[model samples]
Structure formats: structure tokens, C-alpha cells
Target: MEPLSAEEIRRSFVNSTKSQVKSMALPAKFTELPWESLDFLGWRDAKAPNRGYLVVRRDGGVTGIAVSTQASGAARRFAGLCDLCNTAHHVSDVALFAARRAGTAGREGNTVGMYICADLACSLYIRGLKELDVPQGETAAPEVRADRLTTRLESFVQRVLA
Candidate 1:
């Protein structure tokens, strides 16, 4: 992923209105993100407890989406697997986040939700930069896992735009 500027990010959102984009908050470490290791940029908003954001460059432009955390419940008692990285995380560290679809579909209240890491650090997780308790005996090579993570994330983003 390429390093992005605030203006570029603000103009990238597909579902948010002009006002919403203007009011949206960037991630806490927005200016210092590890862009080289990421397939997409995502984070749980620092100030908005239940809000999240994701952005990726595609089709010659950037596309961004806002996400909201679903209410926690008994379902959260069990470990959850992130759909994007296929990583298992502690139930408390996994969140059901939903993004409104792009364009007209969004205006109709269409949204897509999936279990994801609460910290939105799946990129680092797949790259072995984050410590996980999972066994590594059957794991694929770092490059392979990274490629798969990128592909999976792109597919998820496509669904949001579609």
C-alpha cells in the first residue's frame, strides 16, 4: 500500500457524504503507519469507540469505508476468526464490524459485516509481526500467507464496493 495523505484519504470514501468525510477521524498513528507491510489500511477509531475505518487503493483511485462495531454478546464468548486474515483471536479481541455498501446501495441501508480483529492489525498478524498462540507447524511460508491475506482483503473490499 502507498502512503496516503489526509486529503487523499478524506476524498477516498465511497459511502460517506461530504460532511461525514470532513468530520471523520484518521487513525491515531496515521502519519506513521507501516505502509510497506499493509495490503489495506484499517483501524478502530481512537475517539469514536464503536467506529472503524478501512481504505485501499484500487482501480486507479482510493476507496475508503467507515465501519461500526456490533454490540457484544454471548456469541463473543467463543473465539472468532477474522474473515479477512482467517486468523483466530480471543473473543474479546474480535469484533463484528459492519460497513455500509458504496453508492445507492448504501443509501438503502445495505451493509456488510464480518468478524475482524479488534485492533485491525491483520496485516501485521499474517506477516508474523504480531504474536499469536497458534501452532506454526502447518503454517505456510510468510510470502504465501501475505499474498493470501492481500487477496482476501481485496475480495472483501470488492464486496463492499459491489
Candidate 2:
């Protein structure tokens, strides 16, 4: 991943309207982000807790989407795996985030949803930069895990675009 400026990040949004991009907030420590270690950029909006954002490099360009978070209703006693990073968390730590489709379909109320880490820190989780009680015996290398995350996230983005 390459370091991006605030203007670049705002311009990269594909699934958001001008106002959405204008109003969206960057991560709390944007300038200090470890861009080289990121597979994508994702964060929850500080001003609007239900709103989340994701930006990724695709085909040499960037695409970003705004999503709304919804409760998954998973039982508290069970854990769920984030579809993006395959990291397991208590059900409450995973959420269903829905992005309105791009263009006409989105205007018509169409949306795509996926289960993801509540904090949207899949990259850190995969790199062991964050702590989670990962299940035993799942020893794939970090690069391999990152590749999988990129594939899965892009698939979700494609769904929103499609």
C-alpha cells in the first residue's frame, strides 16, 4: 500500500457521493498510519458510529466505499470469523456492514453486506500488530493471509459496484 494524502483519499471514493466524501472523517491518527503495512484502509466514523469506510488499491487505482454497520445478532457465547481477515472474535466484535451499491442501484436502495471486524483493523490483526485470541493450528504466513484479505475485500467491493 502507498501513503495517501487527505485529498487523495477523498478523491478515491467510488461508492460515495460528493457530500459523503466531504463529510467523512479520516482515522484519528491519519498522518501516523503505517501505510506500507496496510492491505487497505478502513475505519469507523468518529462522528457517526454507524458509518464505516474502506479504501483499497485496485488495478493501480483506488476505490472507496461507505458502509453502515448493523448488529449481527450472533449469540454472545459463540465466536464468529471476520469474512475479510478470517480472524475469530466474540460475536459482538464482528458486525454486518452494508454498503449502498454504486450508481442507479444504490439510489434505488440496493446494498451489499459482509461480516467484518468491528474496528475494521483486519490488516493489523493479520500482521499480529493487534492482539486477538486466534484459534490454534492456523499458521499461514502473514503475506498469505493478507492476499486472502485483499481477495475477499475486493470481491465485496465488486459486489457493491456490480
TM-score of each: 0.88, 0.93
Cα RMSD (angstroms) for every candidate in the order listed = 2.3, 1.8
lDDT of 1 by residue, 59-155 (tens): 7688888889965556443566777787787677778888899988999999988878888888888888888754434277767876787787677
Question: After TM-score superposition, what is the CA distance of residue 8 in candidate 1 from its true location, in Å?
Answer: 1.0
Candidate models: Cα lDDT each? 0.80, 0.89
lDDT of 1: 0.80
lDDT string for model 2 (1-162, tens) is 998889888998877889989999899999999998899999999988899999998996889899999645655867778999999988888899999999999999999999999999999999989888646344899999999999999899999999
- State the lDDT at 129 in candidate 1: 83
